[model samples]
Every structure is written in structure tokens, then in C-alpha cells.
Target chain A: MTSSHLVYLIALPLFSSAFLILMGRKADKWGHIFATLISAAVFGVGVSEFMAMHSRAGDMRAVTQHLFSWISVGTFQVDASLLLDQLSICFVLLISGVGTLIHIYSIAYMSHDKDRRRFFAYLNFFIAAMLLLVLGDSYLNLYVGWEGVGLASYLLIGFWNQKPTYATAAKKAFVANRVGDVGLSLAIMIAFAQFGSVTFDGVKAGVHGASPAALTALGAMLLLAAAGKSAQFPLQSWLGDAMAGPTPVSALIHAATMVTAGVYLITRSNFIFDGSSTARLLVVIVGGITLLFGALIGTAKDDIKKALAASTMSQIGYMILASGLGPVGYAIAIMHLLTHGFFKAGMFLGAGSVMHGMDDEVNMRRYGAIGKVMPITFATFGLGYLAIIGVPPFAGFYSKDKIIEIAFNAGGTKGIILGGATLLGAAITAFYMTRLMVMTFAGSKRWDDKAHPHESPVLMWLPMVVLAIGSVATGFLFNSGNSLVNWLAPVLNPNNVESGSELMKPIVVSSLALLAVILGVALAVTKYRTVPVEAPEDVSIFTKVARRDLLQDAFNETVLMRPGQILTAGLVKTDYFAIDGLVRLIGAVVSGTSTFLRRIQNGYVRSYALIMVIGALALIATIWVVTL
Target chain B: MDISNYLYLSAILFTIGAIGVVVRRNAIVVFMCVELMLNAANLAFVTFSRINGNLDGQVASFFTMVVAACEVVVGLAIIVTMYRSRRSASVDDASLLKR
Candidate 1:
């Protein structure tokens, strides 16, 4: 079905963003409210479209809207179009829905900020871009949205660019994302070369005729693009530093919507991954390595937001790993992504609320016993904590456990290794999250006497309450009746697992995950039951390394950044000496010749006449010699 | 007398006039040397007319004399203006165009 309403999903927020920014300080008082309403309106459109899709059946559920013919050449053609299928509807709702709530939350959160109007502008811009990312019909169309979000992310991350470090963090993110964009560009070129098309449907149809090598190359490049945007390993270093942005930016762009773009990309390219096991295995390996890599870093982080950043990385790793599992893993990865979006966004907002009450202090050690002072934040954050730890009746229990079960059921030594790694990740996630909760909420008060913690205003906690409710309900809602999977089946083309091919039963896997969670919580509770206000200077080497984000930045500097710096320096020297020097030499020769010839033009009339006579005589002499 | 002797006399007069123009510093002396060169050229034109048996060279000589009379008038006026402005008539003294 063709629906004209799809364009409004992106247009409203985009126009509002422009209006808010152009209006400047004059709209400061009501700009955030306007932005929030626009976001809510976009959500309203998304929900209405989703309902329209839901009322239909099977393949009829998806809708496309062609705005115009965007690119047309002799044989190449592309349309500026939108697709509101089951997959994209989920993202659209999450981006605009969570986005609206964040906008509301930011209304109160940034009331004191003089640049509140600009903040709303960036938020609206991001919502529009993220919507475009999901709703784009083809890889080329999606790349436009991809770059749009990267630009918005850079802008929002450096929203307070007066701080040099914050500016650096933003540059780091932009540069890293550019590296990944190169991968996306390469993937599109490969798609066009291999299939003569860049659209999802076209690529899917062409995958059968293409060679495995082509498919593998396309999949790997897509994974690189995903890793960069999704903050997967290697390219993952920028995300932690990205905490330098405001909390809402961290929650919205870093934690919830933007970071999951990788999982979305991989899932959208299911046919390519399904075509090549080598590409699929590489995905699993990156996902597995990052899951543990992030989880280990999470264990030692003292900053509340950085800890959440690490956890966000680890959770995205789960989604990436799930997407790698082929037909069985695709829909489950998205489900996990949706649920993680809610819980993680809620927790980040909760952290922001804590910061709001505590004078922007982020160290968890100074946050002991403040839960008593801030009840609503504590309750909302506690629910998110429960959801993330995969406790029963909460969101993560449903989504993350499914990923673990599927990892175990891949049915080989590979399955066992992946399964075990995910299990260990779950345990580590529980430990760190519990430690964060305990360090901030459960222990004796550690804040100084002057600090009087209080609950955030109603506007802030209202969104937290909404997301907390999502955290508690979305998992069960998505899991019951296998609804989410069935809804996405048409898009993902899920393959049914034969009965008894499973390595472990669902109940056994759930029980094992619960056991790991229990062990992790127990260890955290005992260790942090009585915490010191100051983090100990002397600690294990592992603790030290984890505290330093496992030296990912240092690793990047050595492997990528340092070498890049050297190459740049060499190029600069080459430009200065070779290119500039050549031009300078030419300039010097012309000026030297002019200077020597200029002296002959001394303004004496007698000398001028003497030269004219000599020249005339010389010319006559030459004519005479020629005649002879 | 051979018309070639008249050509030789014209060439010698032109060379001496050119030398005078180059060597003289006074503006009046330079102007007089320029007039002498013009007359020497007119003599050449008349000698060539006689030898070639055509009226073209003689007509050209008549035009040259007219042009020379105009040049003398303009040149004397410019030298008088320079002398009045600077209280000197040396061509070197009027070297304001020197680099």
C-alpha cells in the first residue's frame, strides 16, 4: 500500500528544527515545548501508520511512499522514497516516542540553560535524521539518513563546544563515524556493482545470482558501517568519551536510537549475511568480543554516565551478535534493541535526574543513600536496573534471554563458545549494574554536608516514569505469543528451527541466565555493601585497565590514530616543500628577472634616447647582415 | 656630383645628430640636435627622389619638413615649461620617471 503520510513523519520534525533554530532567542521560552509537540506529532503519525499496517495481513503490512525520482542516469535510477514496514515502524516509534519523552524531560532538565532553544533544535533535527535512517527505502537513501544522523550527533555531542575536551569528543565521534561511512559507501558501490541496484528489495532479489565473495564483502563492509555507528568494538572507543555531551544526548543518540543503527543495518541486510557464513561468523566474533570488552569496562567505571555508556556498548554487542545468528537471530536482535532502548534510556534519564539533584556530580561513590531523598528517581531507576539485569517480568529478561537461548541453540562448538560468552556477559552486566545501583542508592550517605539531594521536578520524572513503564512491559509484550517475531517474520524471513536441534531448552537457558544474574548480584552486593567515598588508588591491574576503558583509546592511538598522525605530518611536509616550493621558485625567477630588467628603465631621457638609438642601429645592422 | 655623396652626407649628419642628442644634457641643446636629425632625414628623402626619378620621395620630404616644424614648436614649448618649473634645462634634471 502507498501511504502519503510517511513523509510527514520526517518533515514535521525537520521543519520544526529549522523554525526553532532560525527564530533564535526570541523563541527560547516556548521552543522546547514546540519541539516536544512536534516530536509527539511525529509519533502520532508513526503510531497511526503502524495501526494502519497492523490492520492489514502478511505482506500487505508494509507500505511505501515515493516522494520523487531522486537520481536518474542512463541506466541507474533511485527514488527519494520511504518504507514503513514492520521493521521501520518499530524504529520510527522508538525514535519519535522516546524522542518526545526526552524532549519533555529536557524542558525541565535544561530550563536553566540559556541555549535551551538551540538544544531543542538539535533534538528535533536528530529525530528527523534518525527517522530518515530507518524509513529510507534503499541503501543509498539510507546513507543520506546515516550521514544526517552523524552530523546531528556531532552537533549535539558538542552542544557545549566552549569546553575544549567536549569539542574534541565530538570531533572524535565524527571522525570515527566518517571512517565507518567509508565502509557504507564501499558497500553501496559493491551492491551496485554486484547487483546493479542499491535498494533493499533489489539487493535481496540479486543476492541469489551474486557470488559468495561479493555477498561476503558487502556484509563485512555493512558490518564496519554498523560497528562505527553502533559503537561496536575498535570503532567503539569514541562512545565512552561521547559522554561529554549532555545526558539526554547520551541517552537519545548514544544509548537508545543512534547506537542501535548497526543492529538495524545488519538485520536489514539479512540476505547478505545469510548468504555467507564467513561474514556471519565475523559478525558474531565482533559482537562477542565487544560484549565482553564493554562489560569488563563497565565493572570499573565510577562515572554514572560512563558506566551506562559501557553498558550501552555491551547491550548493543548483544544485539549485534543476535543479528549475526542469521534467520534465527534477526528479529530477536531487534526485539532486544527495542527493549534495551527503553531501559537504557530510562536509566540514563534517571542518572540525569540524580545529577540534577546533586549539583551535576557524576561520581557514583558520592551518591550513596540519595535514593531516600529522591524517591521517584530511585523507583524509575530501580525498575530500569531490574529490566537490564534480566529479572523476571521486566524487559531484558525476555529480549536478552532469547539471545542467549539462540546463541546456545546454534548447535556446535561455535554455539557453545558464543553461548558461554553471552552468559558471562550477562553475569558481568549484572555485577556492574548492581554495583552502580548499590554504590549510588543502597549504601550510607557519602555526599558532603552542603549537598542536599532532592527529587527532580515533575517534568523530568514524568518521562522517566513513562520509560520505566516501557522497561517493565515492553519485553513481556514483545515476547508473549511470539508476536514481535511473527510481525517481523515477513521482513526477516526467519527460518524455523527443527524440534530437538536445540542445545538447551528455553527453560534451562532462562534458569542458567537467572543463576548468572544471581551470582553477579551477590558478588556486587557483598563487595559494595560498605563502600568508600573515594575510589581506592591501589587496585588490581585488571581494575586499573577497566577503569581506563581497557585502553581502547590508547590502542586506537597506537594502531590507527598515531600512524594517521605521522602520515598527516609527512603529507604536510611534502606539501610545504614540494608543492609550495615549486610555486615559490617560479615566483622568485620572475621577480629576479623583472628586478634586473627594471634597472634599465631609469627615468633619464638622455639614457632612454641612447638605448632607442642603439636598438635602431642594431636592428638596421641585422637587416644589413641578412641582405649581405 | 653623385647622389650617393648626398646619401653619405645625410648619414653622417644623422649619426652626429644622434650622438649629440645622446651626449647633451641641456634640454635646448637636445631639442636642436633632434631638429638636425630631422633635416638629415629630409636630405636623404630628396636624394632618394632624385635617384629613383619618382615624386613619392620628394613629396615625403615635404611632409617630413612640415612634421619637423611642428616637432620644433612642441619640443621648444616642453623645454621652456621644464626650465620654468625646475629653473634648469638639463634633460637629466627632468628624470622624474627614473626608478
Candidate 2:
């Protein structure tokens, strides 16, 4: 039963996919229902697991369900075990819970689409992959999940392959992901060679004896992998372009599951991150840098989903920053993870509703004022907005507030700067989100004749409503000592747990931050409201710098994207000349050799046998003479 | 003839036949030359078995002759097919075998 549970996280979707595919032509038509039910059941399993673990809070150790031994030859062995520890359990719950909501949301969002069954299939596979990612107790299994999500992201991003941009966007994602995969594969090899183990438990238990130099090298390489996966710094620009996918795909896989895999990987291997001070510092600095960059870019983005994509990057930055801090790191990190999931899902779905109505147009300037038209979407969107900007009584407020407090109390100027930057980033998040809300839902309808705005179907709205309720209420439930982390505490080391700021500091700082959020919303209310102002065609200078997507666009365009194009072009030209010339030379040589060989083949058998005898005698004489 | 000397002579003869098969252009000649090499090797085996006072080697040589005869039959059938198709017995013209 235990072994089967581990494979269930991986095989169930795969098994169902076979069934769904065999049922083929009809399977896709009814696929969304089965897919959604499967994910929801997985969520039920996660919740039940949490409760089961909760009921047994007296246990101090983790749950190690050994599925089987994956590899064992000589001294090397890696298990196919599934671990239920404090960290994995927290993410298992988050992935399944949020995954179900996204699946349900997709039901109606994709209801009207052609090839809807294929969409459901990809979505189900993605959930299974993400589950495997959190559940796998070994590096090899985790890598499978990592690549699985990458494959899913590519498929979903290019779901509408007819659109050249979507296909290109998918290509860009796959290529950029390959760069990160190289770093991850390299680090895996290094860990295997140095520590002789790739399993989580083996690596954690054994790596303490490894040379600090090797540890630092391995840590830096892992950080590089994490950066590319999490969309920090150099790779941050791809997520913005990844918005070329469907709105729901942009919401779940791109914004939530796929992008966060990097952070999750780093957090899961905290023993490595915590051991190397240099590596932890690198995580904080890169995370802080990416956060500041993502927030600023979001402020200047015009497309609602694009802006939200930028916002997701910035929010993930806070979580990455949490991984760099002390014992409290995992709790604060997962808080941001959960809250961000709810609000970001809401925001993207809300964008979908607007796009649904406006014939899929995402320009903010062209949209204005329709709160009454989409009361459910707007209200849920509003609640989501408050949660995102860290308004009081909303989920983001508590989580973001805790992370910021942890950052400040981390006791350095760097900590203070990160805290302040995170706070200001929240304000900007509010500014952009309010700008979005006011532009889309606050005024009279400004849609063109081809566009007729209407409410999304029940399937879409139901998830929005559900996420809205979670966004509004989850923070309170967490704050009352009934937090998700408490549920996770049974499998953790008590000494390392954050016990999360039972002090006045978090309250004071958070209340002030909430006030700042309101002020931001107030500013947006004043500015974007109908003054008949023409929006700037070019960003104002400071905002333009921000809009260069934190110089990520600039970096990638210069270092990666543009260079790649040039190298490809150069290779094409080289192939035309060098390869063609070489091939022609080979052709000339072959003709020359064939004619020469043909000359030797005059057909006298007696002469050929005489030549053969003479040649053999001469060879024997030559060998005997040389030795003498 | 003493078996050891006869074996060496047969080996040399077989080497000559193989060379002829490789260097000759006429398909019929190359086919006959390959058969000569197989016969020469079989002769060596039969002579060595008589010298060693053993019947097993002679038996193996007998089986080898049967296998070689079958190969010749199959090889001739293929060559005849090619000859019929193209009306030529030039081995170089039959370029289908990449090797």
C-alpha cells in the first residue's frame, strides 16, 4: 500500500491518460470532468494525509515510504521512496489543493475550445508531475518531475500551435529550460561523484564530510539551476513572453507550478544551501535582485496577464529570499507560496474573464469600467487584489508580512533593504493591480463593436469564487495558530521551526504595510479614473528602466537571444561554404578512387592469383627482413 | 602426401583463390574462385584428420562441403537473377551492396 501510494502520485495520471487516450476521440470530449475529479481526489488525499499526520503529532520523525530500491550496484544505492516530511507535506497540500482549483477553473474556461480533451490531458499530466516533484525522496525522481513539468509547460504553452508566437514562446521556454537543465545535470553528477549518493536522505546525511570547496562549487551550480528555473535575473524575461499561452495555462503552469519548481528544489535541499554561507548569500542576493526587478517590470506592463506574470516573478522572489534566512525559512516561504497561489490564480482567471468578454484583447487602455457587468468576477478579482497587495484580513498580508518581518529581523543592512524593497514592491504590486482593476472594472464599458463583455460560465466563476473565499479567509485561519505549517510540524525538527513571530513587531510593520497598500490603491483610483487622459506611449524614464523588465530583457537580448540568432545565422553561412566545399572535395576523391580501382581490375584469374602469391611472399620477406 | 604439408599447401591455395575472388571483375569467375577457396579449406581439414587418425575432423569436413555447396547454389541463384535482370556478369556493375 505504501509503495503504491508513491507511484500513485506518478502513475495514476499516466494510467488514466492511457485510458483517456484509448477512449480517444470521445475521451477528450469528457476529459475535463475526469481530469478535474482526479485532481480533486488527489487534493482530498493530500488533505487527508495532512489530517492523518496531524492526528499523530506526537511523532518526531518523518514518514519514509520506501517504494523500492531504484538503483543498487556495488556501493551505490538510491531509493524510490516517497517522504512525508515538514517541507514535502506542506508542498503536497499546496500543489494538490491549488492544482484542483486550476483544473476546475479550466473546465469552463476551455469548454468552448476545440481539442478540449487534449488540454485536460496535459493539465492532468502536469498535476501528476508536480505531485511527483514534491513527493519524491530522491534526486532522480525529482528530476523526472522537473523535466515532466518542463515538458508540460512546453505543450501547454504551444497548445494552440497554429499561432506562430505561441509555438515560438514554447520553443524559447524549452531552450531556456535546457540551459538550467545542464546546470542541474552537472550538479547531480558532481554530487554523485563527491558524495556517492543522489538520494535526499543520503546526500543530507553524508555531505557534511565533503570538502567545503566541492560543496561551494556544487552549491553555486545548484543556484544557477535554481535561478534559471525560478526566472531570476538572466532568465526572468521568458516568463513574460510565456504569457502567449492560454490564460489558465499562464495562471497555473507558468505562474505557479513550473516557475516555482526552482525555489522548491532549493528549499528541499536546505542542508546544502544552509551549509554554504556563500551559496545562501547567493540565493538571497539573486532572489532580492530578481524580486526588485520583477516588481518594477510589473508596474509598467500594459497587458494584464503580462503584468501579472511579472508580479508572479516578484512574489516568488520573496519566497526565494525566505530560503536564505534562518530556521524560520521554510514556514515563511510556504506561506508566500500558498497565498500567492490563491491570489495569482484569481488574478489570471479574472484576466481570462475580461479576455473572455473582450474577444481576448488584453490592452488596459482599451478597457474601462464594468463592475456591474461582471459583478462576480470583479468582486472576486477585488478580493484577490487586496490579498496580493497585502491588505489586512487577506492571505498575502499575513504571509508577505511574516517574510518581510523575518527579513528585517535578520539583523543587517541587507536584510533591511530586502524588507524595505519587498514592502515597496508590495506597494507597486498594489499600484499595478489597482490600475488593472480600475481600468477594467471601475468605469463605463469602452470595448469596440466586435467586443461584447459577458460573465464567464459557471465552471470558470466557481473556481474564482472558491479562490476568492480562500484569499479572504485563509490568512485568518493561519494566524490563529491553525496555520498550514503547524499541520506540517509533526514531521519536522522542532528546534528549527520558525514558531513565527509571536511578537508585536510583525503586527506593527504589517499594519503599516497594509496602510501603504490602501494608499497605493487610493493613488491608482485617483490617476486612472476618467480624466480623459491619453496614456503615455513611451514609459516615463524611471518607469522605462523598470519596463526593460529589470534589465532582464536587455541582458537576454544581448547575451542570449540575440547572440543565439547571430550564431545560428553564422552557422548557416558556414555550412553553406565549408561543408559544401568539403562535400564536393569528398565527391572528387571518391570519383578519383573509383576510376583508379577500376583500372586495377582487368579480368585474368591466373594473373590475379600470381599477384596474390607474389604479394604474400613479399609481405613475409619484408617482415623477416625487418626483424633481422 | 604427409597431412601437415598437404594442409599448408591447401591453405596457400585457398589464399590464392580468395584473392582471385576479391580482385576479379567477372561475376562467374569470382563465383568459381570463392568455391575453390571453400574446397581448398575442406581439403586441408580432410588431410589433417587422416594425419591425426581421427574421423571427427573428416565428418566436420563432410558437413562443411554440404554447407558450402548450399551457399554456392544460393549464390548462383542470386547471380542468375542479376544476369537476367541486367544481361551483364560484371561484378562492379552490381552496386546495390553498399559494403
Give the CA lDDT, 0 to 100, for residue A73 in model 1. 93
**TM-scores for every candidate against the unseen true structure:** 0.90, 0.78
Q: Model 1: per-residue lDDT, tens digit, B1-99? A: 766999999999999899999999988888889888988999999999899899888999889989988988988899889889999999998878663
Q: Tens digits of per-residue lDDT for model 1 on A28-77?
A: 88999999999999999989998889899887988999999999997899
- Every model: iRMSD: 1.3, 7.8
Residue pairs in clash, model 1: A603-B98
Candidate 2, position A285, lDDT: 84
List the pairs of residues colliding in candidate 2. A28-A117, A369-A443
lDDT of 2 by residue, B1-99 (tens): 555788888988898787878788888888888888888988888887888898977898889989988998998998899899999888877755333
Looking only at chain B, model 1 earns a TM-score of 0.95
Clash count of each predicted structure: 1, 2
Model 1 misplacement above 4 A:
A23-26, A494-501, A620-628, B1-14, B26-89
